[model samples]
Target: MNVKYKLNLDVYKDRNYESIIVAQNDDKSRIIECKLYADSQPVALSSSVTAAFNATVNNVIVAENVPCIVADNAVKITLAKSMLQLAGMMQCELVLSENDTILTTQHFSVFVNKSVINTKSKYEPTGANLATKNDVNSAIETASAKMIAKDSLLNTSTSINLTSLEDTEQIANGVTISVSNNKITLSGTSTAAVNFYLKLKRAVTLEQGKAYCLSLQNFANIANSGCVFYPANSQKVISSSWLLSEVSAFKNAVATYTATTSIIIDAIKVAIATDRIVDNACNLQIEQNNKSTAYANPDLIKSSIKPELYQAPDYTMHYLYVSNDYDEDTDGFGVTKFNSILSANDSITDNNYHNRYTIIVAQGTYTNLQDRYAGLSDVGLVSYRGVMMKDYVYYESENIYNPQATIIKWDGATGFDKSTLKSEDIIKKCPFHLDLNVHTHIKGFTFDCKNIRYALHLESGGTGYATNWVVANCIFKWGGRADCVDYADKTTVPVFGCGHSFGEVGLIENCKIIPTHCTIGYQNHDNADNSSFGLHMKTGSNITIRNCDFCGTEIQARTLKGAYSDTPNTVNIEKCINISEVKKMYSAPAERCDWKVTVDGNEVE
Candidate 1:
């Protein structure tokens, strides 16, 4: 009795969402039937489509390119003995393709239950029957006879017998020929040139405008060796060396003349090539072997036949790609090309909070000069990994290290709408706005602020809190003159700002801040007054800054008073470099915060 295991696979679902259980080494009585669906609809399989089952045991590929029987929307594959060699979990995937183009892939898992009976035996064959020695010898002899008959129709040759040559056949009078041990030798005095022609045993007809390849085997190993051919009943002597300019052809042909030397012509063959007879013979043998009983068995097919090697896919359902110079109609995400980043971000629905996405951005400059902010806002559980500059740049210099190659340039300022003191309203005008319960990551980019107030704003107002965020390997540039200090009408701002009241935690590592203008004193413009600091902190917030470089700034960081006045703000700065003449590393106007600044483990006060 046969047992069937059924599984329903959805293409849009995550990997390993469903699994199947099977017994170990039970290959004969078990089969797996799978029905594939895409977006709640059954996938239609036609005659042009093919499916393959692949599985990995302990991260090593053991079963690759095992064919599956497909009917309509269902696929069935029998268990192979090699796949069940060990009793463990297996990672499996089904690949569907049409005309060699992959349509969709569905991934799942299989658990092989351990067997109690031990059936260990030596010299056990995996096929239906083993071939005897007589059967192998008979197959070899039949293939050899077919190859010899095919060669006779394509080639013609002649043997050289010095004793039977006529006077007219000898071109040089001073040269003489003799035979010993079935070897023909030509001996002559010094200054004697040997050039002669022997009649062919079988006549060969040469057609006009037809090319032929000539070769000689078992001839004398002499320098400048070559041969010439003469057609039947024709006087035209075709020299193989002169007819072909290829050096390989010239080396294979017997030479025309050798001075003062004994030349031995043991055996020689010259042919007119039309097709490869060896390749045809091998293919014929393969066609015959494929009809054998051992090859016909489905269980023995994997060991008998070898297909092309399989390569795993790079990006799966968890990856999204972004590129500016790609067409959406022709390109697919993480397949051949990519689309826009904004489109990739918005495509994630609200119900997919459990899925974490990695947005891969290609190296390019993104600029927005509109009224509203131009970067990603309110996006949670997403990591933006951009292609960095160090991957392409060969030579390192000052300007190359300042602004990264992947840049996000925008002119959004906080002073656009100064009527509202709410943090939510002010964060909408900044480039990057992080809200409550969000874990975001930004890396490998340069935020080019065109004299903007803040490059990033972390909102922490009215039950809102941002936590567990990271900003690494980035640059924050002012994008203005280095000596300009006029700030009468403009609002003074930090590169990054955290709102007051709620608690927050974040980290900034391996970052640089390039302030193009001279530092000015802080001026309170409706309670926004941290002009000289590079990073502004709020009450009840903890931030860690490590391995950073801050230039042209009076203070590195500052903490302001918050609604919870007793809760102190904590800022830890470690292994940071101050290139400018900054007076203090950090300061708290309310004197109710904790600040620790360290350089290579030593505390700096």
Candidate 2:
């Protein structure tokens, strides 16, 4: 077997030459220059080249059996120290080529001479506390010096994994790190407030915009534990400035939360004592408590307790009827107490009896507004509740000479007198009002005010007016007088003036209002007198007038008085026909909101 010799060559810094070629020498022993390459790319003399290589030398036949001297002698190539500055384990090649023709080759490996700048690296100091205090300080100082050299690299990334919080000292000037049992505090003065969000911890506030990192290991100990960092002027329990005084206050509040739990227990005891929970129909089942009638009757209980006990009508249901043939003593429920217009007013207006009864008026013409039921001039049925009247009011033509006039007996002593129905009569009997005392609802009633001032007048007394009133399917015929000038005057303002005053959320639907006399001084325009409208709303809202007919009435069907310098009120009027304009009636020159009126599927602009 033929044997070929091989040798390993390493190139380092030398004084004689920066690179050398290893080969056989002739008598002259002249050196040959071999080109070097890193991964097939030509490695220049000054440039660094860190790569693996394969080198070889071949004897080129120049003229048939004559070999080239330089190609045969050039065997190995040595790279310079300047060419090994790049970081990496690399392969390099030394090629002996003449005129780009392959001659010989050799292989070798190359690596970095030292750590390179701007290169990827990782610290792996482990096993036996390889990193010391001095080592860390030296690394930091070196990094700081490098950053200072390159002024653009002011922000440097650093990572330190702390096993246990021990070396928490002044790592930098005016900077200190601390660690408690459940917290790691890094305190330092900063130029501005730093945004920090740590799990299960309140945001750390630094004095003079200092920076801090508070690590909360046990989150359960903190109240309202969250990872929310609030900025300047943000909504938070603690504001931007977290002074020492604020910190103390927060600590005190935390203790209060614990103390408040005991106080809540005491408060709950007092609440339960004051409002006793008794057995009611909602809780008790029929099988459990079958004997609960749930009625307020003291005499009935006594009768049940003793068989020999006797009791009169308890008036518990509060039913009062009106009829002509009835005695006040015996026939109490059958209309004796509520026989005439005055007597019915007394029973219905009494605070003890009002809102407690269903006043059923029999079919009759009770034209006694002044001599009987007219106790208060401006108070019709002031603060009344519950249902009133069997039939609203039936008008029967008495005389052809005065078709709008009616004749009635005055208390049977003054004989018969021709009394014209005025608007004050309606205001004196069943006035629609909104207050705490009156929750009046007049349903299925006809108000006949042919010669009266108004059919239905709304006058609110006291601070609060009446509410939740529904007047449905009612007819208001022959409303207002031809000469109700007093209504236009300020003597008795808004008294027996307008047909209906809507002061609350009232639903007036499917009603017909026909006023024969549209009264003088009732226009709602510039340089005009008082205009008596069919439906007048004075500073009211949510009044719905739908599916109603107003035939041959004076002025607008629905009008508004904004009361000047008040907020605009809203009313919905839909699907009504044969009425005048539904607009605002200006009383005085004041700031007015453009009325939101829509008539016949068209908005009034």
Candidate 3:
């Protein structure tokens, strides 16, 4: 009879770190728990003499469904259930090898804890007996009309402060407003700073067309400071009105104000500052770009987080948080203040120090880290996304031959030279590999660069790519240089494209990209290969792109790129919002591509 079995590996061993059968009871048994070796051994694996296993965070996983690992001296024979089921079908007939030899297979059975499965109550399907449907549709349709209802969501409460602002004042000349609690008062104060950067310090809005200036005479230390007006839409350091470089310039314009015109500060910024500094003075409140989380000042964030039930022996990091001030001192050559470390500046790997629980970075600007900290290893930085203090060197894309600018990027690699560094080096350095995953989040932030290359480039054994990965509510831009080669002239990549190297079956909801111009032979015209399209629907299904906003940043129209491309991928593209001037740019390219284009409120043709 043919033998069969099923391989099952539970979430017992270190899933985050390198998995090994440690000799706990002098080789009789091994310690099995996830995250044991995470810090030192990033990738982990299950142990078997000659077995195969697939692992997941919870429940049973198929381990070695293919072939059994041969234990030389253990005399353990593991067979798959499929093989035994096939043998039973053959009425217990002895299966012979091709050489007419007795094929003896050991059948191994894997038992999982049934307690792990989440149970739900079962319900009966539709309608009463006899399948009698007494005009249920009509009754349901009229139920709303017959019921009394009121819409509360249509109205939102808003009140303006009559009191004038303090510290500095109006954007317009000859007026200064100050506020004492709710009481706002206006005063005659002229000679406001023309330096727009100064005006935004206290509380002021950034006007696109208006430039509020701040004079340095009144405020001391006017030599190196200005105000910045950062609106809600900024991704990079680019500020509005005179383009603020730092926080000083951005706040300088609003510092000294007039009596006539007042400030229009972003409501969210004030709330965040109030929560962090005013209320919870000791706690940290992340308020860089108030996007999705919205100045999220979580009350008792520690209680919301599970007090980590486990830790790996190799996990080197004991703490993770960047300094409040990270961008300050710089080298004369204008790299990073740490670059001038005539010796080892900051270190995780030091004499008798393999890892630490805390790493604090001094305020400074760092650029082009060319293999300076060569000995650091076994470190993990865990924090919520958009924690604006840290500047990680996430690889953008191929520099073609230049290997620098954001362009077409490949998958994540394993190791890199610290001295001779590339973009991929950052990924290899982060101490811990993740086992827990929160859906619809990768990198937890977006990178804004000129013509960004690969959006997400994780290498083989890529982690964090799962079913609930949501790629939404973001925009990607790319610009072509005046000088370029022939190959790039024809083949512009898509805004977001995952090649054959994706372990994810997630949804790409509400993401947009502008493709480059393509030419014949150089890149495929009207071809999905040349242009990566806004989203790649290759590997896993159950994906959709709904309510997405996309448009080509460049004006060149000879290329053949629209909202999507036809890659014969089985995913739906519904309600895609295309902001392209070209009519053809709005077409959806999937089998279930019945698009319902809604422009504001009206349906498009």
Candidate 4:
């Protein structure tokens, strides 16, 4: 009789039957029919839907990616003889998909019974003998014993005391030996080479071809001395000779040598040449272990196999606070009060400069602004002027989207004459000078430039290239005349400027640039008179301006007087809004300049 099995599969739950018995080598006689359901309703399959059946035996796939017949919610999988070749429990699953997207997967189990009537089948048992528990246990015990014996032979150690010099004899006539405080001192007026023999209290045997370590404690003034190990009865050297200076020394000196033949060491021969004031040697020890050898100790084996559980250490974030209301006496690290941002920046010295610092500025207008140099890593300048300190620290991006409450007011344009200024002086006039190789984050601070040339300037710190500079969620307000007759006038200053260097990459995102006027003069067509810039780009510099609103300024691209000729300047403007009437968003040299301006995924001509 043909064997048929019926089962129900839920879309969300896995089902396991008591046992779906199918005889070995049975293919055509076995058929599995499954009805799919989602909750209490039957699942309806469309024409585009397909089903696949997979069966695994002992983690090996017997039937993989086999297509099954699906009608409405029912699935039929006809077993193949290859799947039922070995009789054992099988894990099966049905996957329903549409257009290569899996809808649901249902897992189930099946059992294939061994058949007595299929004796002639190719999958029949060959009646080979299998290993018993006793055989496996005996094999494991033999392996453990062999490993233990090998480890013991390599790690065996022995110590020898050389405290007494009663039997210490010298082969040369110019040498003398004495012992004090367990140290043997060789003192003499020897101009030629001298040999000293120290007899061992008991003989110690070292195997042939085995590595051994000889360590001498409290050894000094033996720079040109050599040592040779001799056998008990014969004077033949058993180990290779080694110089005392060639070995490693701390408080003690250690040397390694391989025995040429199996010999029992009964004496150590030291040959010292040249005149010496005093040469001292103390407690000596030997071991079979090499200098680079590693073997687990028996006492530490159990602990090594199962180590203690690991737990992460507790972390505490330390922040530097800047507020005008705080007392000046409370200005230091590990405290919450600082008088000004300059003091906070100065407090970070070389001792604790590597620590990550988040200088939080409290709600107040700061006018005592100077050039602050940050030549460290992971520095963040966060302003919580109008927002709560906790809210600005936790939800920074959300709060910075609003109006900035902290204002750093400075008339940076009063005495800044760019035409006659040197390159280093231009960088020194700015408020913040950051290292180009490190990352610095500035957010939620309104820089009110009272006719200043630039609201913020980025310096390269002598690297000649800028990288990892992020200025976000701030306002650059220039309160100066935008139009002037002299093209070198400070009124035509840009909000952001760079040092005398090119940039690798920089970011200015989610900021507002508010200039006093949009156009430099009535000559809007002339590039010089119309140079009201937001960010000044250097030749071969790469800067990205994203999601910023420009009220009355344009991004100016200009080549430095002596910039590299090969590299091109690139400025990427993504999703930025220009609220001014300036048709051209950027200006560059008409010729001899390879510059690229991209606006919202398209290149601007």
Candidate 5:
């Protein structure tokens, strides 16, 4: 390995030579020797003595006998002085291990005699898994600026490992990437987001101003919280939780990666997924005595933290089907009560952050969002749990005679209207919305459709509105029946147990899908094209489903496009805990069984 530093004689005042400590096979758990060279007599000392000399030896996570001096002619250290610093130098080194051996070596020892200003490194930056335009551009600009400052590094075409971005081979060059207000921006002069991804396959050509793109990528297993502004000059990684107040697991996972490498946001997230592996069905499984047909526990989604750290269904809310004004015992005041508490403050707006506006489902089942008024208007985090609907509304009312007609029944659009089916209905008409949108979080509720059409429904792209819906720990059973999914008296629709898409951010997890997981088509369509699936997820939807109980599900999982089927494959029904029957008439997602999904070392079964 060669030292990569920008050459500038002015940076260093004076120096003879620098030494890099490499671990030898002499010790399995600790390093035994230090290497350095000079014109003649070299100084030396033991590593253990150096560790004992430090004031705070326990904090460092590096190996003992750290390099102490950067002397021009003193190739080694004097053991007497070295032993004095031993206690403070105790450290360990964690490297990319091969066959359980460390492989990190220091080069550029000859820099002491040469004119090298960037003594340590002018190393390349780390890459993001899925980078936006800003992330890519910022990285490019930063790297280029540093390269100009340091005139010593070789223009070597090195392969940088960006672990997260999926669907794309590698990060494209010249794609500026930046993070602002929790949003990643990627843009270029000539290339767009799609074109940028396509260009990365061939040598990662950096675009001048054509790159334009954005992506949402998350890092997992980051132990440190603060950002490393620069990693080349010095790898001063931060890991002290005391230094940063609120550190999430995502921060802890990417602790080693500093500003030195590029940000491949897409690649990093993909790598994070690989880091979580246990042979069971869950990443974190907990079944503290859950009985059959039991009401959801108040602790179903328990967290003491104000804002859950690294939580799924992170920040998005849909309307509460059950009205807040209605009675409670059923809700146990789950979301209903949380809503009241969250609304006490006047700082949040209805559409901007917190919204009192919610969905009120009438006591019936409908096939589509045809009702002109049956929708929550620009609300964030609607609360809907513990809702029951039976013989309620079935009429499709249309008024082409009056497109701008106004119809507001009771307080909602889906209610008992004794009128005839028109061309436009209040609940399923134009401009109808099926989403409550951003900052959405729903939990601890069961929707029993009473053998009617599937209990819940969300229309695809109502007026092309983006959906940020999060359905957590809710039960939607008896979904495959004719009266349940997409109403056709006998029409079977390609309905997942919980189907909602069309640019919808559907994050469904931690719930039970009784009688069936997700079935394809409503009652009438399956007979037309026979098939059954426990769950069907569409692609391009930022959906993540994890830690749910799927014991006796009819079908396990399937993916239409980019959507991930949370359900793993090759499931041994006999070994699965609690779940008994599951039907997958069609094939399941590929490589579903290859992963060993377990949480806390416990098998989901």
Candidate 6:
């Protein structure tokens, strides 16, 4: 009564594949129409003019007529090598076109794997010309060969000294050298004349009869010269000695260092050119900002020297360690809070400095003393009720509305009653408010602002917009008003608000935020759309949430409202889990343009 069929085409490039097209037909010896299609183009069909199996030379195809023994009422079609060579997704169709009337049809999607490199040559460019096809092919081949050679050159390193070179012809252009009495002398016609660009940049050169030192300086020259050397004087070139051995060792070290440095530099260059360097890992310790100076003496670095009594302050780096072990008043070494130190005037005044100030917060809860003293008070009058009297009450009836006023009438009548009541003495507030100025970090501390607004307000304008701020391995909990970390632009709207704001490159990683005690302003805001979120990314880009614990009792753990401008704000959430009452971790409307939030790995829809 009903027909069912399935077709499967598993095509691997350059290899013959079998395609099965099976359909239901119970009648014995019934003619069934079958055809194979590659990329929607017909490529094969059942052989002969009868209800029999299909056959193709070399290309295999097996067909079963009606009254078949197989359970699927099936037929198998083999694809030829020529058909398989056409690399693309293939589809097969089976139609019963009897008397120009079709009974049933079936279609299937096939996976096609094309060859990585095609072997057959389709074109012949014989004529010689500047831009001819042959020239193009040759250019491609040469480029490929060069790429391979570069890789090999970067992996291997060799060093050479002038001990064995017969003459200056082996040396690079413009280099003046002399070998005499088992020593090699290096000089130049002009300071910049020598073609030792790599080694000369570091100023690593050989001095007559001086013990050679192996270092990065020598590596550059070896890499530049490819370890080729020349001896200018025959009598002085010792050919083999301890000094010559030192020269060789130094040259070898230089070669290794130079090649490795070049490879790293090339990698960084490629990353920067593609504008995707963010995804790449860069080793800042190796080389920084292209600034290098030659060592005055390598031996001094090796020698043990006494520690200086008075070490000059390194303006390039600043460290403020805040711990409860030391008091803010008595001991000068330690401070209690992070924000207090930031509020102080800028002491280190060096414009030439690239400063990295790290504020290590000790493991303890910090409260802003200002928030407790200057917090909102809770002494107010309660509601009042009216009293029934025998006569009319003397009260302003037309326009007066006082819920707390006690009303009195003409004949012992009372209008309203008022009473003073106090429940919460003082709402808790955040101890210290931070308007981030420098590249600061707040780590390993618990911000206990039970009834306060924000623990750290990263608002633009106290000094400037906060950039490169990180909150890692810290606990921000029990805030009364808003998020522990809040962002707002001071240019347009001076004060920071919880609902909407803007930020740039904020990282919240390996931190904990407990939203249970936070006053997130969702009480009267019954509408889910207008409710507050724990980590509200109203406006920002490159805000990453990695390996953080987010716990909240609100509608959602976070929300992405995007930014004011059309430029997309991106927030990447990786290796983060929602350990809260809310099931839906993130909530974002689809209509918002240029706002993207990726969770785990995929973008949240």
Best by lDDT: 4
lDDT of each: 0.40, 0.30, 0.25, 0.47, 0.26, 0.28
List TM-score per model, in order: 0.40, 0.32, 0.26, 0.36, 0.24, 0.31
Q: Can you tell me which runs of candidate 4 are displaced by over 4 Å? A: 1-318, 329-336, 351-354, 370-399, 412-428, 461-466, 481-490, 499-503, 517-540, 561-567, 579-591
Best-to-worst order by lDDT is 4, 1, 2, 6, 5, 3
Residue-wise lDDT of candidate 2 within 474-556, one digit each (tens)? 55554344333333322222112332323334555666665555432112211111223323334433455677776633232
Query: Judged by lDDT against the true structure, how good is candidate 5?
Result: 0.26
Off by over 4 Å in 2: 1-317, 327-330, 333-337, 348-356, 370-437, 461-466, 483-503, 519-540, 554-567, 593-595, 600-602
How badly does each model clash, as a count of residue pairs? 3, 37, 78, 1, 162, 14
Residue-wise C-alpha lDDT for candidate 6, range 19-107, written one tens digit per residue: 32212122211122333343455443233212222211111111222221222334443333343333322333333333444333333
Ranking the candidates on TM-score from highest down gives 1, 4, 2, 6, 3, 5
For candidate 4, the lDDT comes to 0.47
Best by TM-score: 1
Q: Answer with 2 or 4, whichever has the higher lDDT.
A: 4
Q: Alpha carbon lDDT of residue 388, candidate 6?
A: 12
RMSD values for the candidates in order, in angstroms, are: 26.2, 41.8, 27.0, 33.0, 25.8, 32.5
- Tens digits of per-residue lDDT, candidate 5, 1-605, equal 11111111212225432323222121111122333322233433223222111111112112233443333321222122222222222212211112433222221111011111122333201100112333333232222111111112222221112111112223333333333322223333222222222111001111232221111112222232222111111122111221111132222211221222322221111111112221110011011112221111111112223222322121122222222233456332353222221221112244343123333222232322323234433123233221211111111111111112212112222342323322122222221223323334444344432222234443332211244655454544433333222333532322233333333454545555554423432111010111122224322233444555544433233322232334332222222233433333332333222222233344333
1-605, model 1: which lDDT tens digit per residue?
01122374322134442232222233332346687654456666688888888765433355778899888668876556666654443456677778887655554445443441234422112211111222222222222212111122222121111111111222234444443222234433313323344432112222233233332222332332222222212233443342321123324332222112222221122121222111100000011121122111111112221224432222112344455655747434434235544455555543133334445455567653332343323224243222211111111111222237667666433234323223222233444555434556666668776444356554433332434567777787754222113433343466665552234566778888876543421111111222232224444456667788876553344444422323444456667676443222223454423343344555545
- Angstrom error of the Cα, residue 215, model 3: value is 36
